[model samples]
Target: MERTLLIKNMVCDRCKTTVLELLKTEGFKVQSVALGEVVVKDASKKDDIRLKTALQAIGFELIQEEADVLVEKMKLALIKQMDKGDADFILSKIAEDLGKHYSFLSKTFSQLEGITLEKYLINLKIEKVKEYIQLKQLNFSEIAYSLNYKSSSHLAKQFKSITGMSMTAYKKLQESDRKGLDKIV
Candidate 1:
């Protein structure tokens, strides 16, 4: 039998790799590992207990509540939208993709996270801006376009507003200033 486990704090490819490796090393037949969930084969109750413990030991947690699961799903969806660089009707798109109403998702996200989903997304976008600036491959205009901002000026304004400093200033700062995606909220 296959069992699917909802995981928390899995926000990047490295996290996925870590979870997959841990599962394999712990003698579980891993079916797949995604950002927020994993599927394993023929796992008994003892295996699940061990798996939960192991995952928690490494900063990941098994999501037991359905509401938490939905929130995680929404977060993953928002991340995917950001990666796509198409912010047009993004909330609706996410709701459609997740098969949930936008109002419910928005409400649940704010209630559970104590922060509006839009605010969380803005934070994520700011972090992405920091990443792009650090890469030095794209100019301000390109970064703005890629991130769905109206213009470079707009992007710079939001960046400054969120970071308390200009983009150029942030670029001058150490890379350690950037926050991890999972740590955005």
Candidate 2:
């Protein structure tokens, strides 16, 4: 039977390619792969175990969820959105695209992930913001607008609240010492 495996650290295209290769090498036909998922044509328990082990060896994880699949799907969707879109995407737009009530999605996400959807979005956004800042291509006004903040002031406030430093202060810090997504919460 076809099975969906939720994977961790499958965040980028390179990660997706590695997963596809792993599944193909292991003799499973990969139907599709996105941020946190690998859909297989047919997989048994033995295959699942092997796949889990292979993924772990590569520093990835296979997350199995029956009850909270939708919640996990939502999180993956949000991550994909952040990865692809400009920083200023509207939450209302995301809610509409996901085809669920925003409040319900937010509550379910918080319950499952231990963080509110807004906070999660902020975390993702801040990461993207940091990336943009490091690139040194965009000015603060442009970064704020690209990220969909109301203004530079608004972006600055949120950035400070989350990172405990002004954007300028953060930019001045050594690039090697910048916080990663895991360090955010």
Compared with the true structure, what per-residue lDDT tens digits does model 1 show for residues 67-169?
8998898888777776776555477677888888989989999999999889898899899888889899998888988888888999899998988999988
The total number of steric clashes, by the backbone 3 Å criterion, in model 2 comes to 3
Assess every candidate by TM-score: 0.92, 0.83
lDDT of 1: 0.86
Q: Candidate 2 — which residues are off by over 4 angstroms? A: 88-101, 176-185
**How many collisions between residues are there in candidate 1?**
0
Most TM-score-accurate candidate: 1
For every model in order, what is the number of clashing pairs? 0, 3
